[model samples]
Target: MKRKISTLLTFLILSLLIIPSSLAHDDQAKHDADLMCVFWGDDKVSLSSEEKIAFKIIANAAAITIDQYSLNPNGRIKEGTFNEIQEGLKYFGLPELSINFNDIDLNIKVSNDGKNISPNTHRLYTHLGWNYKKHPNNDFWKKRKHVLIDSVNRLLFNSKKIFSWFPWASDVVYPPSEQCDAFCAIIYYVHIIGDHIAGDTADKLKNIEPLIHYTSMDTPGIIVELKEQLQIVFQEQKNSYTFFELDQKLSDLTISIEKNCDILGFIDTAEKCKKNQEHAEQLLQILSKHLPTLLKNESFFKSRFK
Candidate 1:
């Protein structure tokens, strides 16, 4: 039973392999928040009367880039708030200004999934819990590799541990079809974890409209409460196929999305697509965990990805 549960988790772990161990970020992606605080809060950096107004305009323009991937990439005006940023830069005669914004700084000391992810999206998956040790050597990196595994235990096994980051739901927040690429990992948790029970309590998994419909993430108690519900699947074995079905659905959806979805840019290198691709690989690998017969069925499973 323990081994089966471990195998089940491996499917989830496989999906996370795409996320890099940690992203080398300058701590950007406030989702695109104005970095005014960086300069405004600095006591030593005083602005002149004229510079202050220019700063305000620049700050306002910069704020638009927070958490926004487009507003600016490569330190140049290309995407989201380009026009506004251009105006601010031109207004201040600061075309050469190196403004840093839209950095959410995901220094991922841990992955939300069961194991450490691929290095590509490491920063996207978590923040750094780096120990302030005198020796930050190979031993440190090696130890840090278990970040995702530790997260799995804390999230699923531990009852008292508190989570630091929110599982960013790409489907709800930025569905690849319309907004961004299909970079959703939260659904993996929702589908896999949500497949536990079968009665009135099981209704939560079947109907996630209420939880996903929340306008503000401030009251995300449901997400936390679901941890208790996770215990159901860990103990129950009858619903193992639920994991496979939900995982397989992802493959079908990906094919449909690629053929019909409205993608904004390139899908190959797009971070979101990269995430979705890796997650798909994990699902395909699960065709042999414990339940080899049902999963091995040629008709039941058809994931033909490159």
Candidate 2:
């Protein structure tokens, strides 16, 4: 017998928020799947560990309806129109119910004014296409309804750019800080991952050349690794890094940083304002702990490609 809607939905919500990779990893078919991890500098939620958990939970909840609406833009569901925002959310295979956008604890700001956030004082639900009659110019609603999911998703998950810990808001200007060094380190880590994924015969590492430039320019020699291993991943093409091997290599690299945070180049007072070393330490911790768990999840790995 099939599980009830509530049971199925709980699983979907949990998988989407808590462990996307874990569930995908269990699927043997997706074992060889490869997707580069996404990253971003601004337009992302960067905060402490506890804060991230809360952000993911609420963000996912708040965007559920949008995700569903985007997939089926032609019309409403079932025999009725989408009257409730919760109803739209439920269409995304969510078994439970509608979510309150107000509960999302985030610091998103308007791109233009930089003072306002969505789903909060903005009341995103009311603007959705469900209340089509409310809008005189229905094109705005039509466009928004179609791309709602991705607009939100990009703020959280971006594969095109390297992720950063730098605090950003539209209005706030950040001074030169250690976060730059930390970002440099992560870029090199991604570069090395790209090297292995590309293998020796191919010259695909060019994709990360920009990353390499930024890392070397920012911290100069921050990627402290054994010369032999460096050549293996970079110079040698025959030895391509498989996912498990890549995970092990990434683990080693992060652990190396934990052992020596100086690889982040934080001795100088130039960018020495705040949290550079401390943030680098945090990155090492994330790589050592969080990254390993994420890599092990086959589904999450593939989603990176998607």
**Residues 131-226 of candidate 2: C-alpha lDDT, one tens digit per residue:** 224432344334333222322222223312332122232112322223222322233343233322322222221222111113333222323331
Local accuracy of candidate 1 as per-residue lDDT tens digits, 1-306: 665455334423432322111112222222112122222222234555434433333332222211122111233212223233333333322221222322322122223443433333332222111111222133433233222222222122221223222222211232122100110122122222212111122221222211211333432322232222222322243356644464455445445434533441222334433443443334333322322332223121112100
- Model 1 is weakest, by summed lDDT over 10 consecutive residues, at 178-187
True-vs-predicted CA distance for residue 301, candidate 2, Å: 9.0
Model 2, 187: alpha-carbon shift in Å?
A: 18
Best by lDDT: 2
Best by TM-score: 2
Report lDDT (CA) for all predictions. Answer: 0.27, 0.29
- Stretches of candidate 2 exceeding 4 Å from the true structure: 1-88, 96-99, 105-243, 259-306
Q: How well does model 1 score by local distance difference test?
A: 0.27
RMSD for all candidates, in order, please: 24.1, 19.3
lDDT score at residue 103, model 2, on the 0-100 scale: 23
Off by over 4 Å in 1: 1-142, 151-241, 260-306
